[model samples]
Target chain A: MAFVEARDLTKHFVIRRGWFARPTVVRALTGVNLEIERRETLGVVGESGCGKSTLGRCLIRLIEPTSGQVLFDGEDVLALHGEELRSLRRRMQIVFQNPFSSLNPRMTVRDIVAEPLKAHTNMRGSELTARVIELLRQVGLNESHLYRYPREFSGGQAQRIAVARALALNPDFIVLDEPTSALDVSVQATVVNLLEELQAELGLTYLFISHDLSVVQHISNRIAVMYLGEIVEMGNAEEIFHSPMHPYTQALLSATPMVDPETRRERIILEGSVPNPANPPSGCHFHTRCPAAMAFCADEKPPLREINGRLVACHLHE
Target chain B: MTEPLLRIEDLYVRFRTDEGTIRAVNGVNLEIMPGEMFGLVGESGCGKSVTGLSILKLVPHPGRITRGKIWFRGENLLEKPESAMREIRGRHIAMIFQDPMSSLNPVFTVGHQITRVIRRHHHVSRREAWERAAGTLDDLGIPDPERVMRSYPYELSGGMQQRVMIAIALSCGAELLIADEPTTALDVTIQAQILELLNALRIRRGVSILMITHDLGVVAETCDRVAVLYAGRVVESGPTDAVLQAPAHPYTQGLLNALPRPSARRKSLQAIPGSVPGGIEEIPGCPFHPRCALADDLCRSKTPIMTPVDSSGAHLAACHLIGKSEG
Candidate 1:
């Protein structure tokens, strides 16, 4: 069995309107199936409302999935409750999208890093302080920054601190959600390098979620392309970029602006925005904007099938 | 060659904050040739936007254009009257910003807002203005121009809203369009469409564009000429291909090297250490020297002036080690 396996994961958020109006259910995740081997990163790439983050959050049971089975080392993640759940949290951690918003304004850096250790373990006094110091050093911080608030640090530094907190429990798996989107290019690179170095050193499994394709391509061992809550295509990161199977994935890859001016990519601009997830289009949610969408795409949904070692979901493939 | 459409010389913008004065744009010089897309690329706090704003004298009240000469269409706009500058803002030079949601008026219909700008600048009746607005929106590839005109800003999607904003910009028939991260808020697919429209507008109407963005990819794909800004100064300036191909400034090199390229995966990104120095309290020597790997004792003590790399004077980089490294 894979180290972490997610089968038919789904999530629905009910947006409440006026006093008596009907609640609208936004189908954030329809059905997401994924697996990650030990010491590997599974990258989920998509646009803003595609539910890639929801899928990541669901895998760790951060948010309860409406229906799904997430198996971590042959144990059901959804079944755990109370004490078992708390224990599960120690082994499965998440780094949020924004470092500025994730860290508390009032808590000092030392307190922030030590909070997880205190909650999970019985470390107290000097041992706690020493662990916090060691964690800071591991993430490239020093003794002087121990008592300073998160506001004192730059975006890169704050993200490092967040990474340190995530590593406090020495978790086997960590979900990083758009961790570099808020940072500048220079700062983002440093954070990415740090994450890579940490993963290698700890032999950790990661569920890397990002809308930035290049960042995802850099850190991910396997890449999954999400469109309206469904994994349209997934395979090795290099293969996905080099020869994408799904039309949406191809459009996405071409849309990504290449820094190299020498190679001009054929532009494939998908028309219209992602359909309202609350009232998605019939059959394939991506059919509404897909350029090569056929008549059958509107009436019938396609199943993910292995094509040349890559799983693709499209009517063309069918 | 004829004089460039817009030339900025010794441009400096300062913001008086509680802490102190932040020199946002310091001794920056640039030129946008007619019918060309000039990209001003930089990270946040590098004063790319401020430089764009100072062109139309739109620097917010707290920030003042301390020193500069803005030459536009053979006239020094810095020396022009406030009324003249206002007349020139939309009539000759229009601007589109990153977030269309905020830039477009939420309360007003898209048509009303666009036509209002038309009535303000051009000598046209209400019907002609509405007709022109609809025509512009149609040109922008809005499915139903009339429906989009009637719809409020909130009714439109992010991509549609951006298209509406671009339509408004093109409504004035401006010569120069100052687009400051126009597609940054939209989806990548939508971004491609907007950039295509911008490129098309330049080709069809021969509009000179000053494109300001932090994304090197966007600059590389669209811009004909490029200028890299660092801490309110022009770190490098060259043809788009040359700047991306062979960057001389360490900051420029660092920014490119740090970017996660799609071609290669599972490689560690080259990160420049230390964040952009905060507070414009004029650091001694190079502004980027603190973070630059090539910084030496001399670079730390004295600022290096912009030096041309070739005989064409098209490519320039402000770095003390440029001469040493070239040989």
Candidate 2:
């Protein structure tokens, strides 16, 4: 069985205008379904406001999903509440995109890494310091960094500290939301390699969310392309990248600049911008900008279906 | 190259802080030919944006141009008065910031914002400026420009806001544009459209461009020539193809290797070790020597200046290894 499965997960935020006014609902995630295998990294790639981050929060119950099931090791996560849910948070940790803002400024590196240990377990004083140092070492830091504050570290080093904190509880599944996006290119590689090494050492599963296609392509085993609030296509990394069936996926891939000058890519520039997510299109959300959109695409919303070991939701696939 | 549209000679920028004067752009010399798209690629704090800002005289407060001159079309821009520089800023030279949403005013309608630029540059009446703004918006592939003009910036998507930004930047008939990571905040599909629009405008109007970004791939695809910056200095510069294919400086090579190329899946990225040094005086040797694999005693003691290499003639590298190997 897959380690984590999100079946028909949905979240809608309701905005109340006033005491007398009617409430308006903003649908962030619309019946999203995904299955993450054990010891595998599943990358969720999308533009801003595409609800990828919302989906991540939903899976981890950081923000409770309005409806549907988040099955973790064959148990319903949303069903758990109070201490049960709190304890489950130990099993699943999250590393936010901005390391500088995520960490506490006043606290030393030791306290930041040991906060989880203090909350979840009963270890403190010198033992806590030792454990924090060990966690730091695991994430490629040294003993001398124990007393340093977050301001003393660079962007890459700050992210390493964040990773060390995430690994404090020895999480089996970690939700990395654009973990390396804020770091420089050369430094991004170090963090990514550290994550890969940690995964191998501890048998961790990851849900990597990012807008950067290059980094996503490098780290992911399986990839899902999200548009608006829906997944347009998903499959094994190689298949999705090499032979993308969806026109949206193809256009997105072709638009990306290949580092090699010899490979002259035919960049398909899609005109117009993404539509407003609060007031999405009625039929197919992507039909407005999709180059290969058909008449039926304007009338009916396609359901996600399996075709050739890939899950795609588009008229062309149908 | 027709007097080289923009010539930057020995430009240096420094910021006076509590610690000391931090040298940002150190003796940078660059020449952008007329109607050519030049790229400045570097990581953050490498002085790419500072160079772009120097053209517009928009460097942040306290960050002053310590030395050097900027010649635009045979005229000295640095010597021009602030009042004259104001006239030059949006009229002849335009700039597009990385974040379009923040750059745009929240209260003003998209149409009014665009027309404001047109009115400032040209002597057109309000009605004509508004009309021209709408026309440019339409030309930028924004469907139903009339409705979009009336809408507020918050109502539009990031891609739409960026398109509006481009429309404003191009509406003034600016001869030169400095785009600092204009498409970094956008998605690939939207980024492609923005790049295409810029290229189209450049070709049609014969406008000179200076694109500042950290992605070398962007340089390869869009730029005719590229300058690789490291720690506020141009480590290497040449024709885009020549530099990307075989980088001369170790920093440039490390950056190229760090990129995840589409052609290879199994090849591991050779990441440069250590982060950029903080403070200008924190490091004594070459700024990149701490991270460079081939750093030696000579590299540690002296800073290497730009020297020509290969047959490109345009290709120049600043490195001890390149200097010694070539000699």
Best by TM-score: 1
- The lDDT per prediction is 0.91, 0.88
> Can you write out model 2's per-residue Cα lDDT over B2-98, one digit (the tens) per residue?
6888999999899888888778888889988878999999998899999999988888978999889999978989999999998888788889989
In candidate 1, stretches whose alpha carbon ends up further than 4 angstroms from where it belongs are A262-264
- Model 2 lDDT tens row, A1-318: 789999999889888999988887778888999999999999998887789999999999999899999999887899988898888889999999998999999999999999999999999899999999899999999889998999999999999999999999989899999999988899987888888888989999999999887778788889999988789899988788888888878888888887785554688777677776778987888888888889989899998889999999987886
Instruction: Tally clashes: model 2.
Output: 0
The superposed Cα distance between candidate 1 and the true structure at residue A270, in angstroms, equals 1.2
- Each candidate: RMSD to true structure? 1.5, 1.9
Instruction: State what share of the real interface contacts each candidate retains.
Output: 0.85, 0.62
TM-score of candidate 1 relative to the true fold:
0.97
- Global local distance difference test of model 1: 0.91
Report model 2's TM-score to 2 decimal places. Answer: 0.96
- State every prediction's TM-score relative to the real structure: 0.97, 0.96
How many pairs collide in each candidate, listed in order? 0, 0
Q: After superposition, how far is residue A125 of candidate 2 from its true place, in Å?
A: 0.8
Residue-level lDDT for A168 in candidate 2: 95
Off by over 4 Å in 2: A19-21, A262-264, B262-268, B282-285, B323-327
Q: Poorest 10 consecutive residues of model 2 chain A by lDDT?
A: A257-266
